[model samples]
Target: MTPHNELRLLPWSGPDGKPCFLLSTDGPLSRLAGLTEAAQLDIAADLLEHAHEVLADESSAPEELRLVPSDLTGALGDALRVAASRGHRLPTPGTSDHGDSNEVPHLPAGAFG
Candidate 1:
């Protein structure tokens, strides 16, 4: 699949039961391993940095920025939570399946009854 399509599946639990997703289009991470925990953490940092770059400037994103995963923060995470609670994953770019153009549900009036 294309990098863009591959990225849609990021933050995915890898086959090894690890929480890393592929990025850089350099190939899968299954091939990379070492005897140190720091080595693995380094890989995770690269992935996170790339994720932020893509989200910040979609145009500057590498054409091959494949298999990237998103770790939502702040507003993005809040939106995702509402979506998950109501049974939906990230909305496709520009899609508004819900009645409003925002598609995201507002925090329930006052957030609790």
Candidate 2:
């Protein structure tokens, strides 16, 4: 069982769209969450490729362009959620369990406004 502060953030929402979390990291629920997160990431990747194709086409219709943002918005939300969940799991810098000290985290393009 993980400590309260180390709870795993679930990929799906609970009742009424509330955030869900897992206490145990070694169980059926945890496996399911892992699979779900992987699927979400794969879907987001596919959507991104499609978005790029749509955007790069000079003759794309307004209707086609309009739909890309709506789809991208949802994918972005899932990606951000996944990033936050994984970020929380990373060992803090300067901690005993931290990985290579030379590793530096890079922010995504336009991460800061």
Candidate 3:
């Protein structure tokens, strides 16, 4: 179990559309949340690829183009939620647990280009 102040951010929202959280790190609910997060990431990846394809096609209809933004928006939301959840779980810098390795490795400029 984590400390009271260190609740794990859940991947899904509550009935009121507010964020949910996990207090303990074990049990069925935690496992379900992990699975849900993985599924959300997978869906977001697929949606991103599909969005690129749709945008790159010059002949795509206006209706098709319009739909892509809505889908992308949902995917982006899911991705941001996942990131926040995972980020909260990372060991803080200078902690003996993970040491000072919390810094993300720098990518070369234009690595994605």
Candidate 4:
């Protein structure tokens, strides 16, 4: 019987003991890396980038790589909502609820000054 590789991602850690994110492969992890391993490294690096953002937020957490869906929009939406609720406003996409500032106080990253 042939065994299939299961994708695994490890959170890269900063000096602070929090994971920044990095990609690692072992035994069964190679399959998800794909038919060629070259593409796998690129995907791994991207995962690390995403992990940085995930760690910044107190609400959302980085999940195991295989469990994550290809559709990231919905997952990002939830993260944005959580940030919004905490007074963090996303960059202006266009005219949107500008007048409803009272609904949720939006403080951009550097609004303190």
Query: Which prediction has the highest lDDT against the true structure?
Result: 3
lDDT of 3 by residue, 1-113 (tens): 34456889998899999988888888899899899999999999999999899889999999999999999899899899989988888755444344445565568989988
lDDT of 2 at 94: 50
Which ranges of candidate 1 are over 4 A from the true structure? Answer: 1-34, 60-66, 70-113
Pairs that clash in candidate 1: none
Q: Cα deviation in Å at residue 38, candidate 2? A: 1.2
Q: What order do candidates take by TM-score, descending? A: 3, 2, 1, 4
Cα lDDT tens digits, model 4, 1-113, are: 11123222222225885423223333444343223234434455575577666666667745533344443544454344333322322323343444544444569979887
lDDT of each: 0.44, 0.82, 0.85, 0.41
* Candidate 2: RMSD to truth: 5.8
Please provide, for model 2 over 4-113, each residue's C-alpha lDDT reduced to its tens digit, 9 standing for 90 to 100.
46888888888899889887868899888878889889999999999999999999999989999999899888888888777777766554344457555779889987
- The TM-score of candidate 1 is 0.26
Give per-residue lDDT, candidate 1, residue 95: 58
TM-score of each: 0.26, 0.76, 0.79, 0.24
Q: Which residue pairs in candidate 3 collide?
A: none
lDDT of residue 51 for candidate 1: 79
- How many residue-pair clashes does candidate 2 contain? 0
TM-score of 3: 0.79
